[model samples]
Target: MQQLALFIRKEFIHVLRDRRTLLILFGMPVMQILIFGFALSNEVKNARLVVVDHGRDLATAALIARLDASRYFEVEQVALSPPALEATFRRGEVKVAVVFPARFYEQWQHGRDVAVQVIADASDPNTATTLTQYVSAIVYDHATEQREAQALPYGLRVETRMLYNPQLEGAPNYVPGVMALVLMLVCVMMTAVSIVREKETGTLEVLLVSPFRPVLVIVAKAVPYLILSLVNVGTILVLSTTVLHVPVQGNVLLLLAESILFITTCLALGIFISVQTSSQQVAMLISLMGMLLPTILFSGFMFPIENMPVPLQVIAHAVPAKWYYIIVKAIMIKGLGIAAVWKETLVLAGMTAGWLFISVKRFNIRLA
Candidate 1:
């Protein structure tokens, strides 16, 4: 018993001495709890809403006020023409839009039939559905109040149009998210581990001393994983189309180009991790643990980024997967062109360049 206790105490002291191990033990759980608590919300909040009120009357204004007053919506009443409204959706500016036809209240007052269209960007089916239901509920409550005041049933029909995904299937959202998660973890894990193994075995120093440049060495190390990751991308796309039936709505070649760009970004991140760490175990741990939570939580994969606190949303913008996820959804689900996703593409490209710059810089310092 004494020997066992002494052995246990020695192990605990050794664990306490390693700051990285200690951080993984104590720091990780607290961070995960806080992030999941804040980020994992099903209820909609502060969803951007645009109201096109052709009516421009008292009833329409009252309904708009009610929408703005609700916690779920940030309502903006705009006189957008039909084409401009569609362009707004394609640009991913607003989540939901309410269109009240001309003389909405006038028709209601005359006991004539009328319809108010609720248009939502349904690329993220869950959020689109929730926002639509919230709108419906609000409209229903307004109708009920009018019925009571007039002592007659004033029926107001809420017609919901879920753009890009009329049926609201789960595949369209999850497939893009899964692509982000898989590529990030796999590419980062493999590239980091391979290079770290070289370092651990003292082979990396030989390569750095070789005729080829150190930056070339790092890129060479990442090339195999890049190829493998592209294979993974192809496999995922095939399954998504064949099994899940979620077709690529945009240019296939464009989607492939974006996927390659994102893969390169992940490889650059892996190189950075490899240059920072000295052990294969540590590199693997960092690649798996470091990328997993951020990719899942901050990438807007499992949760809505807007629902998180401001600090968390700021953290999300730093995540490369968040930009890539948005790009994938735009291309794969919404059929949007490069014109709509150039900003996100630029972000991923910048991140790749940044990570590679830092990695090459650090690798040179180690060589010196």
Candidate 2:
């Protein structure tokens, strides 16, 4: 009994001595709980929206007021002309646009059915479809209230039109999500573990001391993984289109270009992880807990970002998968070209550069 107790005590001491391991063990669960509890939600809120009210009458004003009051929408601007509304959507400023016909109020008052056009930026088909539904429900409710007040038999008719994804297919929503998740796991987690394994075998130090520049050594190590990740991207694209029947509506070359960019980002993140940790186990754990969980929960794959608490939403913005997911959906589902998704691309490029810079700096400091 004494021997067993001594063995247990020794193991505990060893565990506690490694503060990084201890911190990871304790911090991972808390992070998962906080993220899953707060950040993971399907409900949409504060969706940026634009309104164009040609009616400009009491009825139109009341409907717009209802939308503004709802938690689901934030009325950002009132577009003066159709071109202005187009500009807003083109700039990615708003996800939804509400357009009321010029004689909307007059038609409603004359006992005729009125139609309010709800145009959604279906780049993210799921968000676009959900926002359209929410707005339509609000419009229907307002029409019902007006009908009751007037003691009318018929109420307003609200028609919703999804711009990019008229069918609202689930594949379009999930394909990009799956791509982001898979690529992150393979590129980041696998590369991190591979690099850490080299360190554990004592070969990484030998390579560092080799005649080749440290940056070249790191790039050489990353090149194989980068190529593998790109092959995986091709496989995903093939499966998404052939087996899943999800069409690549945009330019295929452009999608490949973006995929390469995202793969670079993940590889840099993996290098950063490798630089931080010496143990393969630690690298794997961080990759899974830190990268995988956030990719799934905070990247709009399983939950909408707008539904998360404000602080969590801010954190979601930092997740690389979030931007890549948006880019994929915009390209694959919306058929939007690089022009429409330039901001997301830029953000991802910046993240990649930042991760690489930090990794290089840390690697140099460790060597010094």
Candidate 3:
């Protein structure tokens, strides 16, 4: 008990003394949350658009008014011809070009669907999609209102269903990704670098030469990190659920279990990396560039794998961060129980086992 307390105290002191690292560990996440919530989001507004209204009649005027009135489209240009509209898009002056066919109102009133062509830069797919939706929504709303006034049902019914988050609150998705990143950084990177630091400083040799068993030494080194990682998990959970108002509908126990499993896997990975590298700097480099980038890119945090190119999507499957992100999303956002996340749990277990086995093999090779 005394030894354990001493070890805990030493670890806490080490953590606290590194003020820069401590600040990054605690502060970066808040910064990332703010950035993701405000700067980067699927919900777009005030997009600059060009209107090429060939009809120039009451109906086209009304549609233009609707488009401008709604917050989505900002009428930036009123180009007269297709060539001018194309030039506006080429110069990136507008995201969308709204073209109303000649005699559009006359055709609609004479039993024809009003054909409004929305030309968008497909190179920027997200912007194109949003702009198209904005235009379609305005046109649909106007058409529906006109039909309803004459006691007729609108021809279109847009049934939009948001799968995971109905309200699309930013935190539900970001919080889980943040937690996974934190675990990867604090748990795995810290463990690997800390172990490598000991090796570089020759303390590892001292420990091995001591009477303490190798496994016990490893456990002692990892125990402090385990506690720190758990504290971080608690801190994030509290902030996300309480301040961000993201609900945890799943069993808290199940979430914690998955979190623990993820932490263990990361810690084991760190140990494996530490065994591979000879210096703290090398470990840190590997952790950041090699591990961190893949964790963020491949983890479905920024881009949906379903939409990614086939080869990139295939590569994402091997990244442990991907599985951890899925588990966190399932448990946190979807309120899935253990049964729902068992496959993810198994994958994490497998990764942990693989890393541990590698570490053991390396340790034995070094001993020999």
All candidates: TM-score: 0.60, 0.59, 0.85
lDDT of model 3 at position 363: 69
Model 1: lDDT equals 0.81
Q: For candidate 2, give the lDDT of residue 146.
A: 87
Clashes within 3 Å, all models in order: 0, 0, 0
Ranking by TM-score: 3, 1, 2
Top-scoring candidate (TM-score): 3
Q: Kindly report which residue stretches of model 2 are placed more than 4 angstroms away from their true locations once superposed.
A: 1-156, 364-368
Q: Give per-residue CA lDDT, model 1, range 151-192, as digits (tens).
A: 775455455678997755566777788788878887787678
Judging by TM-score, tell me the better candidate of 1 and 2.
1
Put down candidate 2 lDDT per residue, 150-184, tens digits, no spaces: 88885345567788756544556777887887778
Candidate 3: worst-modelled 10 consecutive residues by lDDT: 359-368
**Alpha-carbon RMSD of each model:** 15.1, 15.3, 3.2
Per-residue C-alpha lDDT of model 3 across residues 275-312, encoded as one tens digit per residue: 88887889988887878788788899877888989999
lDDT of each: 0.81, 0.79, 0.78
Off by over 4 Å in 3: 54-58, 76-79, 153-158, 167-172, 238-246, 306-315, 364-368
Where does candidate 1 have its weakest 10-residue lDDT segment? 28-37
Segments in model 1 whose C-alpha atoms lie over 4 Å from true places: 1-154, 365-368
User: How does residue 342 of candidate 2 score in lDDT?
Assistant: 99
